[model samples]
Target: MSTYGSRGDVEPMAALAVTLQELGVEAVVCAPPEDEFRALLERAGVEMVAAGMAVKELIAEAKANPHITLPERARKVTSRQYEAVLEVAQKADVIIGSGLMPAAAGARTVADQLGLPFHLVAFQPVTMPSPYQPPVAYPGRPLPPDVTDNRELWKHDAESMNVIFGAAVNDHRVSVGLPPVPSIRAYVLNKRPWLAVDPVLSPWRPSDLLDVLQTGAWILPDTRPLPAELEAFLEADQEPVYVGFGSMAMGNAPAEVARAAVEAARKQGRRLVMAKGWAGLEAIDEADDCFVVGDVNQQKLFPRVAAVVHHGGAGTTTAAARAGTPQVIVPQVVDQPHFARRVAELGIGVAHEGSVPTSESLAEALNRALGMTRRAQEMAGQIKTDGTLVAARELGVA
Candidate 1:
């Protein structure tokens, strides 16, 4: 299957592939060739291939090739990525994939040509129209008070995506020798939709259009031992609060965030573990109790921490949930803010209002999260089931 993005995007696919293997089907994840999560996939013994462009390079290409609109580049990228996975999937009996522009662009059309089953996957309710909540991708800010509880507006979320991206999506169809889809609904509704998230997070809301089967989160846990230094830190007298924003570049913002995190740590009188993410947050100075390190497995670390602080990516959110730790959600992009909202709604964490995390805001959220430990722990127990294996059962992989 093809998948891409940072740890949040690719790691889930790796976990699913591992689960398929456990069900007696050989599976490989085609993902961005990044070492952070790739190392975890490797440790899990799941096969990962470089598919499409790397996240860092994709960003660079967008900046360097500004003449090409992002949507257009997305189309071109997906077109280029079409055959790489199809070449592998067509050989197999079934095709399952998610993540990134290219994989979503052409996988289904190619699978349709071969008359093979293409199981579509989703990490969140961002795409699906739901009665329970607004579309995670809804463009408008602060809902008008009247539409607050109305689930009908949520359906338009998918419609808006189709309206914006329909032509680009059809370009993929024409290239793949498939008929153009009339709408986003036509494009996506043809497949058996598999939602690879915890049912607790994406519980089935009433909907005629979305017959989504919720599998508990597809968690391919990292199996490696933590670095000796990190392990020692965990064993220390004071439990540290964790901080890391995966892959979201913080530009000139890191120093402030670092300062905030340090001050926040000081205010709480707690130790800290700060991950210098993609150079997002650098260590400005040595703090007595804080340890700044590179990407490490959250699966192994969150359990030992007092709380998790990050840019609320699905993987990080799920990891912290499973670890039973409260969270400070400093979301930076799409789907992240949605997860952050869920964190607050479920009483497990705090979701900041905007993108870019400020230290003061993070500290406020962290304090709130610390107070919600009981709720967070309760959620941890509820979402711990393996969604990957459940997905295999649903798709009849066995």
Candidate 2:
């Protein structure tokens, strides 16, 4: 299988690949050549195919212009990824995409050519193409027709959808002699579709979707040790608000954002644990209430926090949800806004309005998240109960 995105995008697929293997299926993940990610998957004994471009470069380009990044770099890299995975999937009975991957798309193309069955896996509600009506955030923009409640966003029609596929991706596939497939109605997992993901699932709405099959986030068994700084922070405070912006902080003025986040932490009287990867916190003086750490087990850390504040990456969003902790989504770009809207619409948290945010906005959103009502907690719990075991059954592995 292939996953095409930044670290947030690749890690979930790695975890899912592990899960799939646990069910006695051998799997491999197509990832960028990042040593950190590459090493982890290597340690897991999963085959890793290195894509041509670095994820860092792709992220930089995307941050510069999110409007076309998905179609350009994401789609192009993914198309080339297929050549690497074909050696394995051709001999296998089934193929799956962690989300959208060039390999997955390529694999899908090969599947149609060879008449094989392929499944597309989603980690976010917006990606699932489910049938549940998403709450209206922007009035008159009342959600697209492609989103639904379904857990799996399988491609029903490959023809028309293929045309809407990015030109870069299309050219790559055609160069490889792959026939164009028509676009199928993609199930929108979350109603918001503006985020960074496959665009073939556009023009969708709640009515145009199906009910969610899998309801909860996939839970991975944690066994890694925490870095000393992270451990120290955990020991210093029983629970703190987790804060970090994944790859989103690379190009932005991270220090300013970090300072604002730190200030907000102080006002709320909550301990702060920023992901060590947080870009701009080096200039800030560390207080007893603040700590910076590397390699947090998000599944483990998020639940223990009083709240979470971060760029609204899909994986982080789900991690916060799984922890049953309210979140303050300070989206930087792309799908961040889309996910932030979902966080607010679900009443799971508040969104910091506008592309740029201030400490006050961050604090307010944090306050609202920490003040989640019983209804919001219950809804979060419902999603927590999602069973991928049933998904295993559907794959005929359970």
Candidate 3:
């Protein structure tokens, strides 16, 4: 398995690797070489072959140089994958690609070179093209305002993909002695792509464009106990509202976002547990009513919380849902909006109107979320925890 992106993208692959190993298959992951990623795979007893640049460095560079085109960045990442994935592909019976588009493209070409079957998996349904939904617009390339038809928007989407990744992919293919692909979009996604999302949270509607295999969300079973401080806080009073933006650098003002979350939870007469994630959020002030933590296990903590206010990444959203915790989804970008909408549609949470949340907006959303606790609890029973086992069986590992 090979992937590159945030924790949301890499952690699922680690979960799948662990499942495959339990089924007597030797699983190795080629992913970004960040310490957190290495620790995650290490805990699963899986081998990690570093691929691509460090994700934090990539994000920082992108922010530093706003003028760098998407195509240029894609080319650099694709080149790195070609160099790193060759050794792993040589030993694997099959290749699986996920996360960023450029990384997947390079892995597919490596599979082509070695005559290995390549499968592309999406953690969310939004990335997969369909007539039921339009494609995610590329940065700096918005869809035409006049184009209302989904099909038309998808056509435009295809063109934009080719414009961004076609050359980078085709150039690598030709260098590897493989024929150049005509359409980068079709080349990567036309095969029966697998969608690794919970059917209840993000359902897939069939389309003519691609054959999709909808599997439940791949989850890493975390057994780590919460810290003593957090445990004491939970026992002291009413359940606190939990707020964290896992892996997201919460825009330019993370401190502002943290303050708003703290204020909102206070208005509802609830204590607050804030996670200082990649955004490095801190408690606005030192008080017994609020506790700040880092990289704790949500699986153990979410059930104790009154509500979850978060940037709606796939894994976090699914974790909170499985714990039967109501949510307030403040979506930032990419597939986050899709998850936000689904949470609202299920009546388990409120999708904040926009990304930047003030105290008033968060309090309002939290009020709505707290009222739907019963629905959330009922829905939790319907969430499947066997998604990793299912994926392993599908891969013929079990």
Q: How does candidate 3 fare on TM-score?
A: 0.98
The C-alpha TM-scores of every prediction are 0.90, 0.75, 0.98
Q: Candidate 1, residue 147: CA error in Å?
A: 8.0
User: In lDDT terms, which candidate is top?
Assistant: 3
Better of 1 and 3 by TM-score: 3
What ranking emerges by TM-score with the best candidate at the front?
A: 3, 1, 2
- lDDT value for candidate 1? 0.74
- Give each model's whole-structure lDDT: 0.74, 0.61, 0.90
TM-score, candidate number 2? 0.75
In the range 180-289, model 3's lDDT, one tens digit per residue, is: 88788888874798899999998888878778998899998899899998899999998999999989898898989999999999999999999998999999987778
Regions more than 4 Å wrong, model 3: none
Candidate 1 on 1-398: residue-level lDDT in tens? Answer: 77666767777787888878877888877777776657767877887766766778888887787787645765755665566677677577776767753456566666777887777787876666666656554333333556665465654555665655566777778766888877755455454577777777656665765677777788876766789988888887678999888877865577787888877876787888999887467666765588888867778899889989888777788889989999988887777878888888899999876666556776777787899989988888888567887888777874
RMSD of each: 2.8, 6.6, 1.0
Question: By lDDT, highest first, what's the ranking?
Answer: 3, 1, 2
- Residue 121 CA error for candidate 1 (Å)? 0.8
Q: Which stretches of candidate 1 lie over 4 Å from their true place?
A: 136-159
Give the worst 10-residue stretch by lDDT in candidate 1.
136-145
